[model samples]
Every structure is written in structure tokens, then in C-alpha cells.
Target: MTAPRLKVFSGNSNRPLAEEICQHIGMPLGEATVTSFPDGESFVKINENVRGHDVYIIQPTCTPTNQSLMELLIMIDAAKRASAHRITAVMPFYGYARQDRKDQPRVPITAKLVANLLVAAGANRILTMDLHSQQIQGFFDIPVDHLFASPVFFKYLEQFKGDNMVVVSPDVGGMKMAAAYAGILGAQLGMVWKKRTNATTVETVNVVGDVAGKDVLLVDDITETAGTLANAAKIMRDSGALSVRAAVSHALLSPIAYERLALGHIDELITTNSVPVDTRGLPIKVLSIASLMADAIVRINNNESVTSLFKIKGF
Candidate 1:
């Protein structure tokens, strides 16, 4: 079968990651002019012809959330108008995913809203990693290829598999992810009881499971303020845990998170480079997911099954 002509372009958000992905796929990054007007308007122009091509726009809705999202939408619209055969939005880190539901009386589901925006902007499909809620995929009218960061984290964590390790969820909600980590690493499972004091604060109540004298690894989909991980680490340490570390998929570190990580309660933070993260001299190890994403892109372009990529250590 003849392969579809594939072209990949990137927005201003996390250009380094897109470049890495291009390198992994053995292709040069597509030519594009993405800039800002003096009035703060985003300007995007595809310098190369994308007519009838399977186009993928690499843009992560990272720190400057609104700008990145706007850039992606504009890029998608540009591709659609330029007569691309298929347009896929490659979002390594999806912002506004936390507002997936309405727990409050009158709140908007930004995740769904973003999904609508993507569809309206002419995205035929989406590729993202480790969403805040898995259900967010259901909101999209277009096909969403949700990728997990576990495969990348697993290889980096294999060295500590034989240690007396306990994979813990920093909060009640993250139990499922922790359980998966525990099952894959062949470690004990644990959970931390916590209450959200505020948006940026988390108060840990207690720790469950046996963590005494064992190395604790907290697992979560995302960490912005680091309150949950830091507080959980403190409680685990107080409960006689030998060491406390955290393995988070997306670490959107805020100023508060930087301060918390500097406290040293958590010995190390293992995370993926879904978004651009600055270590800032902290003990942060950012594992790259570029190769994994590149492979997935190739599979998607080839119309191949991505099931094998989802498997983790025979689990």
C-alpha cells in the first residue's frame, strides 16, 4: 500500500519537543510562520504546501494556555483552508482538561468546550497524552488518540523495581493510575487521603497501606502546585517511609510548586516532558515521550493498530 504523504508542523508552544519528534520520525520539521501581531493577535502562515497531505500540527497547550490554544486553532484552520487531506492536532499536554465537569452550580466544562473548538477549527483527529480525565475523550466529535506516559516512565523506573517500593496515589482520585503503576512494577499499592483546602493547596489526612521502611512512589496524572505530592510525601515520611518520590505524567510547575519541591520532602520527581518543564536546579528527571509519540504518529499514518503500544510489561 502506498503511504499517505505526511507533513508535521509545530506552533510556538514546545517547539523543542516537536523538533525531537521530527528527528525521531526521520523528517524535517515542516515550514511555518507562527508569530504575534503588535496588537497581540496570533498570525500563522504555512510556508510549505500541505495540499492533500496528512498534516499533523504539534502544539501543546502549556503554560501560556490561551496563546497556545489559539495558535493551535489557527493552525488547524489554516491547514483546513489549505486543502489538507487530514488534519490532526498533536497536543502532548492538554490544558483546560481539569474543568471536565460541573461539580459547581454554574460552571462550564472547558474540556468539552475545547473539544468543540477543535472540531469547529477543522481538526479531523486529536493526539494527546495523559488527560486530566479519561472521559474528556468522549467530548470530542473527532477521533482522539489518547496516549499514556507510563511506557516512558516505566523504562526509567525499572532500576528501582527490586527495591521495597510502594506505588501510591497522592489523592483518592488517582488510585487507578497508582494501581496500574504498582501492578506493572510489581510493587505494593498505597493511597493517601487528602482534602483540597483550595485550588493550590492540598491537606493530607492519612496514608493507607504498608509504606513503613519502604520507598514510596506517588503517582498522578498532573501536578501544578505540587501540594498533593508534597503533603503526601510528608505524611508518608512521618509514617516511617524510607524515602518518598513522585512520578507524575505532567508537571505544570507553578511558583508554589517550585517552592514546595525545594522543601525536600519529596526526594525526586520523575515526570515526562509532555510540556516544557524547567528543572530550576531541583531534583527533577524529565523523561521524553517523543519517540513514543513519533511511533504512534507513524502507526496512525500507516492505518496500523496502536494496541501493542498500550501494553505495559505483560500486564
Candidate 2:
């Protein structure tokens, strides 16, 4: 294989993960300055020569969403102007994915809008993991390598699999993911019927499958408020579940979510380090995806197939 002239840069969103990935790949983090003006406008400058080099910008549009997003755009433009041969947006946690569809009248598909913005900003490709929905990939016309955190999640879960295990979806929408986990672990599949009363509140009406006296594993793509997962855990415990644990790809957990986790409604909250989570004072457990992401980046740089990254038996 030919050596890939690869370069990895990062924005302010998730610098620690980027640094870890760079370390895993045995490459120094690309030099770039990402800062904002007093008026909240983003400014970016590439400190090293990147002309004709294959560049990957690691930036997750997490908290302070707009500013981070703008920073990514500016960096992409900067790389393009510096004559980079290829530019890939490496977003571990894809934000604005919830606005993928027009569910209501006058609604905007901001996910699609973000895609357009990236393309317009001179990104040649995208590398992200565990989007809110699979269809969100269609929002982009460029090449997209969508990855899963299941490999990381499954590795951690392998230690806890037993005969009394049951994999559960926090809501009906996540049933498919739950079922896959169940099949892989040889556990029962269960789902909670959840009703969204508003933007922040969710009610678990009932459970669809048998979870009685079983160790429950609740799986979801992401969680922000922790309301849905916490409520589902309470309902499952009340319904005779022995223990309840949750595993999510992206945990953009709010302060309330941290409080809930501390209160112990859920047994274990296993998640990937896709975003910057402050687990210092919480009972949440985070698994590293640096090696997985680093491998994908290397493969992409070499023009190697990335299909195997998505082939989780239960996912």
C-alpha cells in the first residue's frame, strides 16, 4: 500500500478525542488555530503547510453548536484555500441530526442544511459515527463513511452477558437496535412504549416484551436529557426487571441527565467518548473509540474499503 499523506486537525468541540485518535495513529495532531472573536464570530488558521495533502478535520458540532459549526466551516475553507488535495469532515458526534425530516409544518431539515454547508465549505467527504437515524446519510450527496459505536459498546458488554440478560430499547423507535443487541448477546428483546409530551419530557407507558426478573440492557443512539432512559429504567424495575443499564453512542447529556444518573435510577450508563462528557461527578462510564476512528481514518486515507466498520452482527 502506498503511504497516505494524511493530516488530522481538530476544532474545539472534542479536542481530547482527536488527540487520542492522533496518538493511536502515531501522528502528531495537525497544527490549527480555532478561536472566536469578541463578537462571537469564528476565526481559523492552519499553522502548517497542507498543500495537496489529504486532510481530515476533527470537529463535533456539540455544545455551543453554532460556533463550533462555524469553526468547522472556516477550517474547511482555510484548508481548501491552502490547496489541500482532499478534505474530510471527521465528526464523531453529528449534531443537528434530529432535524433530519420535516415532521411538522414549516419545519426545516437542518441536517440537510448542514450537509450543504459542509459541501459548500469545500469538504470532499464526511466521516461520522452513529447518526440519529440512518436516513440522515441521504442528506449528503458526497461520500460518507458512517461508523457504529457498537463495536466499542459490545466489547464492554461482553463481560456482563449472562443467562438472565435482556436487551431493551428505551422506546419503540429504538426496537431494531435493541433486537440486534439481544440477538448478539443471546438475550431477550424488549421495548418501552414512550410518549413524548414535550421537548424535554417523555413518559414510558408500557413495556412490549418480557423483562421480568431479567438483567436489562437499554440501548439507544443518543441521549441528552436522560429523561427517557431514566423513566424507562424505573418502569422496567417496577415491572420486575432485576437491573437496568443503558448504552448510548452519543451522550450529549444535560445537567439534569447527570443528576438522574447520580440518583441511581439506572444501574450503569455505558457510552462512547464521541462527545465531551463531564463524568467526573456522575456515575456514567465511557468507552474509548479512538482506535476504531483512527483505523477508519487510515483506511480512508489509503482508499481502502470501510464497509467492515458497519458490520456489527447485532447492530
Pick the lDDT winner: 1
Candidate 2 Cα outliers beyond 4 Å, as residue runs: 1-4, 311-315
TM-score of each: 0.98, 0.97
Error of 1 at 34 (Å): 0.5
Whole-model alpha-carbon lDDT for candidate 1? 0.93
- Tell me the tens digit of each residue's lDDT in model 2 across 168-255: 8988789888888888887888888889999888977888888888999999999999999999999988899888899999999887
Tell me model 2's lDDT, rounded to 2 decimals: 0.90
In angstroms, what RMSD does candidate 1 have relative to the true structure? 1.1
Q: Which stretches of candidate 1 lie over 4 Å from their true place?
A: 313-315
For model 1 the TM-score comes to: 0.98
lDDT of 1 at 241: 93
Question: In model 2, how large is the Cα lDDT of residue 105?
Answer: 100
The alpha-carbon lDDT assigned to residue 203 of candidate 2 equals 76
